[model samples]
Structures are given as C-alpha cells and as structure tokens.
Target: MTIGLDMMGGDFAPLEAVKGLQLYLSEPGAPANIFLLGDEAILRPLLATHMIPEDRIRVVHAPEVIGMHEHPTKALKEKQQSSIAVGFYLLSQGKIDAFISAGNTGAMLVGAHYSLKTIEGVMRPTISTIIPREDGRTGLLLDVGLNADCKPEHLNQFAVLGSLYARHILGIQQPRVGLINIGEEEGKGNILAQASYPLLKENNRIHFIGNVEGRDVLADKADVMVCEGFTGNIILKLAESFYEMTHRHSIRHEYLDRFNFEHYGGTPVLGINKPVIIGHGISRAPAFKNMLKLAAKMVKSDLFDQMQIAFRN
Candidate 1:
C-alpha cells in the first residue's frame, strides 16, 4: 500500500518530515511506499541530506501550503496545489491508500468531508484519541472534537466505530463500550446521554456495559468511552494538561509520560472512506513517524471495510 505524507503541513516542515521518514525506514520489515507531498525545491535537498532511498519514496511537487490561520474550505479551494489539497487529491484518486498530515486541522477535516466523503450509512464521521488508562492499559474515546452537538444516533454510531477501532487496531477483543455520564445508574445525565443509553444498550453491534462516570475514564471501567464532542473534548484537554503540569513542576511518572500525544501519534478521522490521520500542528519527528505507522496498521486491518460491514448489518 502507498501512504501519502503532507510534507509541508507542520510548523517544521520538510525537515521534521524527512527525519520522520528516516526513522520509519530504520525499522525492520518492508515499509510502505510513501508519496511525499511538498515543494520540490525544499524536499529534494532534505531527502538527499537524509540519504533516503529513492526507490522507497516518491516526491510529489506541491508548491503551495495552507496556513494554520486560513479558512479551511476557502484555503482548500483556492490552493489546489497546496500539500494538504494534493494529498487529498491523491487519496480520492486511489493514488494512496492513506494520508497523514500535521497541518491545519480545519483544512484536513474540510478536505476529508468533501473529497473522500463519509462512509455510506454513517450519520456523521467522528475522530477518536487513545486514552492512557491508569492500570497500564489504553482505551479509546470518540467524538473528541468533531460534531460537538450530536443526536443519540450519532453516539450509537460512535460506539460501534470506536469498538471496531479498538478491536482491530488496538487488539482488544470484544472491547467493552460505555456511555460517559454523570451517574453509573440508568436514567441519569442530560437529555443526550439519556437518549443514547438505550440505543447503546439495545444495539448488538457493540458490547455496551452501561454508564461510566468521569472517574472511570482513567480507570479500566470501560474500554470505549462514548460521549458528544463537547464533553469529550473537555475531558481530552483536561487530560492533556496533566502532562503539561507535570512538566512544569519537573514531576516524572511513567503513566503521565504516556499522556504525551507523540507516543500514540495522531488521531484518525474514524468514519472516512479512506484512512486519514491528523497529527498535532507542533508535531516533531517521532509524532510523524508514529502517525505513518498507525496509518499502515489501519490500512492492513482493512478498518474501513470492517466498519462498512458492521454498519450495513
């Protein structure tokens, strides 16, 4: 499978991306063919400096770039030759199996929605992040920042999507699904939570295990935490602060270290037609490397196919 990398997306473009390719190539096993999208003038010299093999990588010349502050839809339309736009074009044309970018998040989302489009039978596509549980295990949280306002049906789809992702990419067989709520007992939480609980309980697509309180997020109370983006994003940001706080005070702990976004790479737009990963705008080489690895795993697992089959039934 060929993976597309947006070489001009992040703050330290070309250099960090080239170093990331170097790190990925250093690992054992046959790596996927990579299509590097960026300005040929800048990327060629860096590739040469890094001594990247030409046979394993192909450079696609993309002269423009979408800035972080630019409007998402506008930038994509105006800058057709930009790296992000070029990457999506390649993905939609089947030139690449997956696309990875650490650039403007808005442009990436806009491109995925319009270019690849959402999978059939999906109400709305969602993004998910890996939650590092306290027991030295990992869990998945969905709708972290996408679709802040959602219906019960959206949460139901999120559960199924999150469960499928955990089972396939995370290797968690029969991952337990939980609705994030204020109370563990039935008939609690706001209107959205109350409405979603029944759908999750009744749906056989996921292994629903009732409500999970905020405290359960860090513990292993549930393997897949389902919530609307509003609440989920709050929890995600709060969790991220733990690492920042620790770093400020010079406190070092193994569990807190896992909170680093670099370790897990980037989060994928879970319900898209093709695998599209969005990394942090400030991502370094390690984060970029991990994002490529994650894309490879998702492609190998045929994650979109599994999701389609599950949603169809």
Candidate 2:
C-alpha cells in the first residue's frame, strides 16, 4: 500500500516530515511506501541529508503550498499545483491508498468532501478525536468541529459512525455509545439532546448507554460520545488545554502525558470513502510517524469497507 504524506503541511515542513519518515522506517513491520508531496528541490536534499532510503519511498513534487490562513475553497481552486491539491488528486485517482496532512484543516476537509465519495446512507461525514479515559481505556468523540450545527438524525448517525470507529480502529468491541448532554436522565438536556436520546436508544446499529454528562467524558462511562460540533469542539479544546496547562506549570504524570496529541498523532475524517488523516499543524516527527501508522492500520483493516457495509444495513 502507498500512503501519501504532505511534506509541506506542518509548521516545520519537510524537515519534521523527513525526521518522521526516519522514525517510521526504523520501526519493524512499518507498512506502506511513503509518498512525499512537496517541492522536489527542497525535499531531495533533506531526504538525502537524513539518509532516507530512496527505494522505500517516492517523491511527487508539488511546487506550491496552501498557506495555513488561506481560505480553504479559494486556496484549493486557485493553487492547483499546491501540495494539498495534488495530494487530493492522487488520492481521488487511486494513486495513494490514504493521505496524511497537518496543513490547513479547512482545506483538508473541503478537499475530502469534494474529492472523495461519502459512504452510502451517511448523511454527513464527521471528524472524531480519541478521548483518553481515566481508567486507562480510550474512547471516541465525534463531530468535534465538523458540521457544527446538526439535526437529531445527524447525531444518531454519528453514534453509529463513532461506534464502528471505536471497534475497528480503537480495538473496542461492542463499544458503548453515549450522547453528551447536561444530565444523565433520558429526557434531560437541550432540544437536540432530548430529541437525539430516543433515536440513539432506538438505533440498533450501536450499543447506546443513555446520556453522558460533561464530567463523564474522561471517566470511561461511554466508549463513544456523540454531540454536535459546537459542544464537542469545546470539550476537545478543554481537554487539550489540560495537557498544555500541566506542562506550563511543570506538572508531570503518566496520565497527563496521554493528553499529548502526539501520542495519537491525528484524527481521521471519518465516514469518507478513503482514509484521510489530519494532524496538528504543530506536529513534529513522532506525530507524523504515528499518522503514517494510523493510515496503514485504517487501510489494512479495510475500515471504509466495514463502514460502508454497516451504513448500508
């Protein structure tokens, strides 16, 4: 399998990406041939300096790059030669099994939507983050920032999507689904929560466990938390800050280390036809390596096929 890497996307471009490739190559059973997408003039020297094995990889020179602040739609349309655009082109044409990037997130999402097909029966493709639970197990949270406003049916579908992801990617079987809400009772919370409760409870596709309050997120009360992007993003950001704040104060602990985004690498734009992993803009070597690992796992697992079958049923 060939996995495309956006060598120009992250804050520390080609450099960190090269270093990450080194890390990935050193590991045993590292699957997928790396496809580097960026300026050939710059990438060639860097790859040589880093002593990257040429036979294990291929470089697709993309002369342009989409700036982080550029408008997603506009940058993609105007910068046809940009790394992100070319990466999408390769993916759409089946040249790459999956694509990984830490660049303009808006551009990545926009490209995925337009360039790839959505699974049949999926209302909207959602993005999810891995939630580190207090009990040492991990959970999944969906619609973190995509589809900020969603219908009750959207939340219901997210439950199914999140559950399937947890099972296939996170290695959780019969993953319990929960709706993020203000209360634990079935009829509690906002209009969206209240309306979504019955649907989740009724949905046979997932193992629904009723509502999970804000405090229940990290407690392992649920394996898949479903919510609209507005609330899910807030929870995601707040959790992210815990790691940042702890490091700022010189607090160290194994538990806090789990909050580091590098450990998980990045989140996949779930529900899409092909695997597209988006990394943190500030991602370094470790994060990039993990992203490659994730893309490989997703492909080897035939994740999208399982998702398509689930949705079709």
Candidate 3:
C-alpha cells in the first residue's frame, strides 16, 4: 500500500515530516510505501541528510502550500499545486491508499468531502478523538469538531460510526455506545439529547448504554461516546488543556502522558470511502509514525467494508 503525506502541512513543515519518515522507516517491518508531497528542492536534501531510504518512498513535488489561516475552499481551489491538494488528488485517483496531514484541517475536511464519496447510508462523515480511560483502556468520541450543530439522527448515526471505529481500529468487540448528556437519566438534558436518547436506545446496529455525563468521559463507562461536535469539541479541548497545563508546570505522570495527542498520531475522518488521517498542527516525528501505522491498519482490516455493511442494514 502506498500512503501520502503532506510534508508541508504542519508547523515544523518538511523537517518534522522527514523526521517522522525516519522514525517510521526505522521500525521493524515498516508498514507501507510512502508518498511525500511537497517541494522537491527542499525535501530531497532533508531526505538525504536524514538518510531516508529512497526505495521505500516517492516524492511528488507540490510547489504551493495552504496556510493555516487561509480559507479551506479558496486555498484548495486556487492552490492546485499545494501539497494538500495534490495529496487529495492522488488519493481520489487510487494512486495512494490513505492521506495524512497535520496542516490546515479545514482544507483537509473540504478536500475529503469533495474528493471522496461517503459510505452509502452515511448522512455525514465525522471525526473522532481517542479517549484515554482511567481503567487503562481507551474509548472513542465522535463528531469532535466536525458537525457543531446536529439533529437527533446525526447523533444516532455517529453512534454507529464510532462503534465501528472502536471495534475495528481500537480492537474492542461489542463496544458499548453512550450519549453525552447533562444527566444520566432518560428525558434529561437539552432537546437534542432527549430526542437522541430514544433513537440511540433503539438503534440495533450499536450496543447503547443510555446517557453518559461529562464525569463518565474518563471513567470507562462507555467505549464509544456520541455527541454533536459542539459538546464533543469542548470536551476535547478541555482534555488537551489538561495535558498542556500540567506539562507546562512540569507535572509528570503516566496518565498525563497518555493525554498527549502525539501518542495517537491523528484523527481519521470516519464514514468516508477512504481513510484520511488529520494530525495536530504541532505533530512531530512520533505522531507522524503513529499516523502511518493507523493508516496501514485501516487499509488492511477492511474497516470501511464492514462499515458499509453495517450502514446498509
């Protein structure tokens, strides 16, 4: 399998991306062939300086880059030669199995929607973050920042999507699904929560465990937490800050380390026809390595095929 990487997407640009390649290639039985998308003039020297194996990778020179602050739609349309644009183009044409980028997230999302098809029964594709549980196990939370405003049906669909991810990617069988809400009881919380409760409970595609409050997020009460992006995004930001603030103060702990976003590499856009992993803007070598590992697993496991089957039913 050939995987594409946007070498110009992150804050550290080509350097960190090249280092990430070094890390991945150093591993025993490296996962897949890599396609580096960026300026050839800059990437070639770094690849040589870093001693990256030329046989395992190919470089696709993209002379342009999309800035973090640029509008997603406009940048993609105007910067046809940008790394992000070219990566998506390769993915759409089946030249690559998956795409990874730590760059402009808006551009990544826009590109995925336009370049790839959503699963047949999926209403919308969602992004999810890994939740580090207190019990040493991990969970999944969906629509983290994708759909801020969602209807009851959207949450219901997210439940199915999140469950599939947890099962295939996280290796959790019969994953328990939970609705993020203000209270544990039925008919509690906002109109969306109330309306979504029955739908989740009735969805046979997932194993629903009723409502899970904010406290349950870290308690391992649920394996797959479902909510609209607005609430989920707040939870995600809060979790991220916990790590940042604690690390900044020199607080050290194993649990705190688990909160680091680099450990998981990046978030993959679910419900799309192909795998597209989005990394943190500050991702480094470790994050990039893990992202490639994730992409390999997703492609090998036939995860999307299972998702298509589940949604069709």
Per residue, candidate 2 scores C-alpha lDDT tens digits across 128-171 of 99988889888899989998999999999999888888888889
Predicted structure with the largest lDDT when compared to the true one: 3
Instruction: Give the winner by lDDT: 1 or 2.
Output: 2
Q: Write the per-residue lDDT of candidate 3 for residues 1-313, one digit (tens) a residue.
A: 9999999988988899899989999999877999999999999999999999999999999999999999999999999999999999999999999999999999999999999999999998999999887898889999899999999999999999899898899999999999999998999999999999999999998999999999999897999999999999999889889888999999999867888867888999999999999999999989898999999899888689989998886
Off by over 4 Å in 3: none
* TM-scores of all candidate predictions against the true structure: 0.97, 0.98, 0.98
The segments of candidate 1 whose C-alpha lies over 4 angstroms from its true place after superposition are: none
* RMSD list, candidates in order: 1.1, 0.9, 0.8
lDDT of candidate 1 over 1-313, digit per residue (tens): 8999999988887799889988987788845889999999999999999999999999999999999889999999999999999999999999999999999999999999999978788999999999988888899998999889999999999999999999999999999999999998889999999999999999999999999999899898899999999999999889988887888999987768878766788889988789999988888899888989999999999578899998775
- Kindly report which residue pairs in candidate 3 clash with one another: none
Error of 3 at 176 (Å): 0.7
